[model samples]
Target: MKQGARGSAEAGDRSPVAAVRVPAQPRAVDVDRERGIVSGAVRGEHTHSEQPLPRPRSAVQRSSVRGQILDALRTALVTGELRPGEVYSGPGLGERFGVSATPVREAMQQLALEGAVEVVPNRGFRVVERGTRELAELAEVRALIEVPVMLRLARSVPAERWAELWPLAEATVRAAASGCRATYAESDRAFHRALLALAGNEQLVQIAEDLHRRAQWPLVGRAAGRGRGRGELVADAAEHMALLEALIARDVDVVRVLVGEHFAGAV
Candidate 1:
């Protein structure tokens, strides 16, 4: 007999019948337990075993968040929430605003490009410190660019075109009367931008805006400290309306004088 036949005969003789063995299939619970161990080890304490990880925000969502951060930061700068010469971390600002640090960082980078803040390596950003001399320099550059173009616009653009900007001018006056510095600053910017837009040169308008923003940074925390009253801002708004009226009247000489006086008094 063959060796397998001999072994089967011996088993049958000893036990009266042969017994067969089969392997057991893995259970669902055991499989799940193994997977849980792997996932928990990989994710550590920051993840749940049953829940999935969150996906990153989409590009559009990120862009919208960044824009919101930028606007909020601008408001903070204008309203003196972010003081000049003070250093701020992106994470800290994000925490305060209940957002992630990414948008705050992007916004700060934009503000840095606009000369509103300086980036510090290994740290964050410091608001640019402005002195009277620097403000004067900024005013001079603004005047040099704005005065000539405005005077030209006064002579060239039709009175009807100038009339279209009346709403923006009126808005500035109203904002000033409300005595809200942030609102007034924004309205003031709108008035200038609208005035510059009459020239129809986008580059010129952008440059003027940059200079205007730089000029405003220094006033962040100094309004109350310097005893500068809302009356001063109201007077400035009145002057803007007067300038618009002069432009509509095609009074180049008056516009020139007003532009000079405006820059002179800006500081």
Candidate 2:
């Protein structure tokens, strides 16, 4: 959920780009827009044999393919798969994606615009890392943007809509109780998405979605596999319930305080 220094990224012996080798199964993607990095993969749902084993494939499959590749790439970058100062080439990535250079080039260009990749003269792209201070700033920006949005949604959203959210919150709790990190993580995200659904602001939702993706960068699925204790998980669930109650009551002060506390604890 946090970004680290480029020097920290450099310390690892493994080539940053090597981690981009996709597992056989689908995994999470974490993208840090503020730091221009991304990483993470799903965990706890698969054994080693079930990892997303990579294979050659065509980019012509569908728009989703490009989107998936972008997601995968973002996950890698955020998770340090493509670490800072690491060299990357479009053609090399095309080979990895089983596509021609065109799509890879296009994708890389898009990432560059997003500030995730830097084009070096006569070289390919390099994953740039942020300083600790920069990472902190990123977190601050997220807090500023998300806390208010959640509070506003809390005040305006109605009770019946909360029924839709309860199931997702329950799912997160169930996943946490079962020690299924990936499932828990997905459910956890779904719960928040459910809350945001009431906002009816497409641009805000998109922004929040991007921020959530960045938050995933720090630990990948590790958070799910080794989540908070059961009591803590229940407490978290209860907080959501409290939010719903406040929404049902149209208690703006209570909702704002609850959201602030929840995010302070969670983030």
Candidate 3:
């Protein structure tokens, strides 16, 4: 029956059946690409807090929600907005961030992997509190790793390379004067990275930056009970410039001394 029916339909059946044409339909819009998704350009009845946090840098626009949240949480950790030993729930933070808890939880787990926080079973993630001794040890280790590198770069690198870093050192100074610890801390890191990069050791830069970041955890308002405040940051930023100057002059003695003083005050 199937073969006979197929033969009759194809070979020219005189049946009076007419073919019906289907109409084309509009394509569906991807929900994530809709206006409110990416930029602050979201248009709708969203209240202020419901909007995404402003990302001043264009590079941040390319980041996923998880990466953005990670950065935001890191900034919170540094600025002491997220206090040490405090437990924060993913859903609660997600609401503040105008997103779902999935991204927040993902970001928090990344922080956990970085040793910045620890999971609290069903409760939430608790910020890891560092004692003075831990911070001191981190600073000591960082100094031991970086001081010799700086001295070597100063002695071997051309003066032109040191001059090229003036902008980075100056950036730290500007960030310090702006009274934003997070900003200054970033600039401070950039300067150190650029300095060590002259030695052509990629691993050295990564390790040094890791220690620097750990030293910066949960500072708890540098002016409050245990805060170091803006003055100390400004002084530290100024040392970057001073250290660069010594590096350019190829003053290994001065570079070693400056590097020592800088790390000594890191804790």
Candidate 4:
């Protein structure tokens, strides 16, 4: 089972936010690898009678291959390309991605550890099902960790440091306005990751990110069904900017309230 954060501090006495270090965007090589795997069949490079044909095993970089497959699978999970309760076999996904099954299995195991998938006895892995109750529980946990941390950062971090996050915040809003769930989700994660990193606690940032990723999984199907429209996503983006502004202004009250409201309505 995953562990939650322990202990809390008063926001007023917390230290200022530190310099933010945003993760690098996914490289084109990763995208090209996934595209080759997923689209190879359509392009007649790795297909036979409409069936996917796996690429030959070569002395390619194993670590890079695994990372790319992981990225592709994560995207599928977040975009509803992989559905809840759907069983996906390692070899099956491997063939779809035009790679061998080893890397695919490795990738799935990592996802299983993250609670995104569960291993079956003889079958492959299944996407874990999440409903309203699960979502609420996730939101509550997020609020517990994020509310206090954000409030502390808002009080401590310099306004100039908070201002540095505007580009990421704006990117998220733009993604939402574009009405693309995948783009918005990626941007949303980036924005939050940047914000939380200011707390200068790596472990806390990781835990919060895990919760955020879990929260996003349930939205895939909804996003696909139009259950979450562009307006709602845009509103979400706007709230992110508002929260950043509040943090910059050192309004702990507004920051606290915004953090709670953000988690409550995140789904």
lDDT for each candidate structure: 0.68, 0.55, 0.69, 0.70
Model 4 scores what on Cα lDDT? 0.70
Candidate 1: residue pairs that collide: none
Model 3: pairs clashing at backbone N, Cα or C within 3 Å = 222-227, 222-229
Task: Please give each candidate's TM-score.
Answer: 0.73, 0.58, 0.75, 0.74
lDDT of model 2 at position 59:
27
Off by over 4 Å in 1: 1-63, 219-224
Candidate 3 segments whose C-alpha is farther than 4 A from its true place: 1-63, 219-224
Tens digits of lDDT, candidate 2, 162-264: 6667777777767667653334445666777767767788787767666655554433233323324556656776787787778777788998888777766
- Give the higher-TM-score candidate: 2 or 4: 4
**Where does model 4 exceed 4 Å of error?**
1-63, 219-227
Query: In model 3, how many backbone clashes occur?
Result: 2
RMSD of each: 22.7, 11.8, 18.3, 15.4
Which 10-residue window of candidate 3 scores lowest in summed lDDT? 19-28
Candidate number of the best TM-score: 3
Clashes of each: 0, 17, 2, 2
Q: Which stretches of candidate 2 lie over 4 Å from their true place?
A: 1-64, 170-190, 218-254, 265-267
lDDT of 3: 0.69
Cα lDDT tens digits for candidate 3, 1-267: 111245433422232222111123111122225423431112221222221222222122233767877887888778766777777765445444545555677899999988899987655678887777777899999988998788778879999988998999889889998988788878888998898888898999998888888888854333235555789889999899898889889898998899999999987
